[model samples]
Target chain A: MAYRENEAEAHDEEHHEHHIMSPKVLIGTWLGLMVLTGLTVGAIKVDFGAQANLIVAMAIAGAKAMLVCLIFMHLWFDQKYNVMIFFGSVIFVVLFISITFIDTKRNEPFRDAYDATNKPTPEGRVLVEPTVSPISTSGSDAAAQPGELKVPEHQKPKVPWPSQLPDTPRVAPTAH
Target chain B: MSEAAIDADAAHEDDDHGHHDEPFLGHHFKDHDHQFNTGKLGIWLFLGQELLFFGGLFCAYAIYRGMHPEIFVEGHHFLDVNLGAINTCVLLFSSLTAAWSVRMAQLGNKKGLMLMIALTIACAFGFLGIKYIEYSHKFHEGILWGQLFAPSPEAMEHAMHGVEANSRLHIFFSIYFVMTGLHGIHVIGGIIAYAWLLKRAAAGHFGPNYYGPVDFIALYWHLVDLVWIFLFPLLYLIH
Candidate 1:
């Protein structure tokens, strides 16, 4: 019991080293984040060209993210391992994004070609045919008027139907 | 030894080890520091995974924007920048309170911790409320994703001013809804976490020696804020 009490006292002494962020730092970080937020919003007003504007917005956002991770999340006062883990994840994310961008950039020509060849229907133009059945099988004269299928020009099937295909020669029967 | 004798010995051993005395400390951990460090490491790993999860959406946004910069240029005009900015401020304030709550827990100030936690919860709800307004406005305007991308005539006028609506505008809204929807889900998760913390705190469950839960949840709340830090600029402030 006495030994446990002594250990507890030592633990108490060690506990003082545990870092607790000050309110001053927290408030300052908050204020900085707010100012950065304002800057991001305000940046949209200026004509920095599209790419330059995106870069400026991202830069400010990156700063705010750093502040949140370092201070709000206490990575600054945290163990080195924690910091490494967080940053390693960020690096992986960057790699993932960049690789995806590279792949997409390489495929841009294909995508453009596809888009050009198969243009989507114009706005408010529904390409799907109405759901009601258009064919009639009754022998009556009026029923002989097979309903015309209003298939969209682009959506019409390219291959002929089985009934429309040329007949093939019959094979000889095989011995059982 | 007999069973009763073994049980007695185990009880005495626990008494000597002082595990029972510290109700909050886990029996398996060597000490408070061990438990706290382990919990912190676990949360950090989860956060790392979370980054990658959100990273996928960001990659989609990058690819789509790269291909259709015009869509983004037109799409962003439909989003309410003022509401987005207000929500950003709200989240930032909530993050401050969350961090402060951790400090409060560390300092063993129950009232301060409770106050900060409550404030953080309030701010989170405020953010979601503003988000609700934005989403409803979009829904009403028919500015939606995929096949549902038919913008009302007025919405089209508002978005384009005079330019024709891009057919691929739905792609932008798709990215927008997926990203913001995921973030809003995280906010809801944070609210649930904070509520749990609040309940434990009301029962006087946290203090300097056992504030790991508070700290872990605060880290999570900050991460949600971190995601929004990038999201606000990417989705709302597009050029």
Candidate 2:
């Protein structure tokens, strides 16, 4: 019992040396966090453009994140290296975003090239419901009603397109 | 054998134990403030690096988002705002308790310190529980991540409830899962840390002048909570 009591007295004597932060800062931080939380939820109702919407939401989230880090997490009281850690994270984020965007840009050229290779060759025609009319009906009554008309030129292109439209007029011409 | 010698031996044992326990202490330190400062600086450095690590993930999110804002929003619709808001509240409050625990430790209030630490752990568990609920909801909706990721009807229902919705929306869920999952993992780590600290604190290992462990842990727990603050808004609060 004496041992425990002595330990307690040691703790009490030690407590006389340090200074805790004021209650005002704590209350202010709490209030600020609640307000930001409400705003984040509120922003959902306002539909900005796709990109702007994300930007606004993220900006608010960042602010809230800062509050938690600076105030609640006590980065406010820490040494210089603590600041270094935070900034280092920010630099990494920049690198991650840059790399990802760079890759996206890189993929764009490849996508175009891929599309070029698989473009429709017009080599052959599989008979189907044509997309556009091939012949003119200047003096004939053979033309069907517009609603029920079938066009030959505008056919839905074939599967497995092998190449681009071949460089010449190879198909026989239809007299208009 | 005699009472006088037995008393002398007990005093000697205490002196030896106290000296051996303070190896990291310095001459300038009366109560281990030097060790505390070193440990605090170390934690802050670790936290700074962690911030950057998570920052990298956020940057990835930004790129994907920039490339496909519509897709991102489509996924955002799946998140439950009400639940997210509540979780934010829980985490923010947990941070408060963590702060209080450190304060109690500094005051050498063992009972108060233990209670606050326990409170913080409970808050972490609560955060985890809520996270599980959110994740299970995603699972039920068929929403997932990576190549196997899919959209839940609820997610889709929430997502395109009012937009030019399409199948491309699944990608949004993909980012959401990656970001939130990583955050969830951090919350788990903090919970384990809290438990260890709580045990030590309850055993009265800390006094007013030697509570660096509690401060560092609180700093970490706050960061964990802080990360969620950003996550909640990004994931759940977009139209």
Candidate 3:
């Protein structure tokens, strides 16, 4: 063990240069993340339309994630291979999401027809032709202009089952 | 440089076999640097795999949101943005402490390392505590996933003030619970890791040449924070 220790010490002397991140950088990263969080929340108030809002929110989140990775996780000072591995995973994620989205988009019409025809009414009544387009993306506009989108009556479910039914089953006599 | 010297060194190494100078150094490793580098590589690979694991859920989220924008518009109203924002800040602060703990371990500051680890654990618990509040409120309101979703009248009345409730609001809640619940589980895992780290740190197991575990765990914690960074905007601050 003594000889092994000496050998280990010799190796350490030759190849022991680890980076220790400074507290200043860590604190700064935290602050940046917090500010980005605030911006994401704040951006929701401004009317950027649905798509633009999503883009802005995602952009801010991406920035915050980058800060966490580069500073807190030390990817900036890490080996190039580690960076490659991380980005490779991110690339795969993009591929997975985008490919799945393309497929979903292709089959959207079939899904819409199925949902329109199969959706059960709150009252258990027969399905009705949807008064409004189920796949409408203008939800904010619909909300703003309330009269433009007719509020569906089925949104509110009538509860409390009637106590007496006309077709109730009668009890049978028991054998002696 | 002679064969005789090499033989004598091997004999001396065998004589000292039972008494290791650095007990923490694995016997299989040639040196601390070698062990640290190998462990670092292993951890980076694990982290990459973890990203792919989470990417599956993110894909599901994008698909769902794209299909039903109204559901997200209505469902997000029920989530407390303030609580989610607070949790985000809590995780970010924990990440900071986690990184600081690695630095402390590298500098051989045992007390500082322990303190940072404890802070990180506390912040994780605090984040979970906030999540518990949000989840319990939803549970009480019957805001659940799939067939179990039966939002109470009061909840609907409160949540759907001016907007109409989509029939597929349950899908939104389903995504919400799955994404955030998985994140919560990860936070629990981080707490457990930090607790173990704290115990080892107390025993002086980490120092300048042996802080690999500390660095690896901090890298993991930052990834957790990274996930939440996206989750906060996607789940809570939906436009």
DockQ of each: 0.33, 0.27, 0.33
Global lDDT of each candidate: 0.83, 0.69, 0.82
Please give the range of 10 consecutive residues that has the lowest summed lDDT in model 3 chain A.
A156-165
- Point out the higher-scoring one by TM-score: 1 or 2: 1
The residue ranges of model 3 lying beyond 4 angstroms of the native Cα positions read: A1-16, A123-176, B1-19
Ranking by TM-score: 1, 3, 2
The alpha-carbon deviation from the true structure for residue A44 of candidate 2, after best TM-score superposition, in angstroms, is 2.9
After the best TM-score superposition of candidate 2, give how far the Cα of residue A13 lies from its true spot, in angstroms: 25
TM-score for each predicted model, relative to the true structure: 0.81, 0.71, 0.81
Cα error of candidate 1 at position B71, Å: 0.6
lDDT winner, 1 or 3: 1
The TM-score, computed over Cα atoms with residue i paired to residue i, of candidate 3 is 0.81
Q: Ranking by DockQ, best first?
A: 1, 3, 2
lDDT of 2 by residue, B77-192 (tens): 66777888899999988888888787788788999999989898898898889889988977887777754565545655565665546444556666787788888898889988
lDDT of 1 at B125: 94
- Give every collision pair in model 2: A85-B48, A89-B52, A131-A154, A132-A151, A132-A152, A132-A154, B141-B152
**What lDDT does candidate 1 reach at residue B144?**
84
Q: Which ten residues in a row have the lowest lDDT in candidate 1 chain A?
A: A128-137
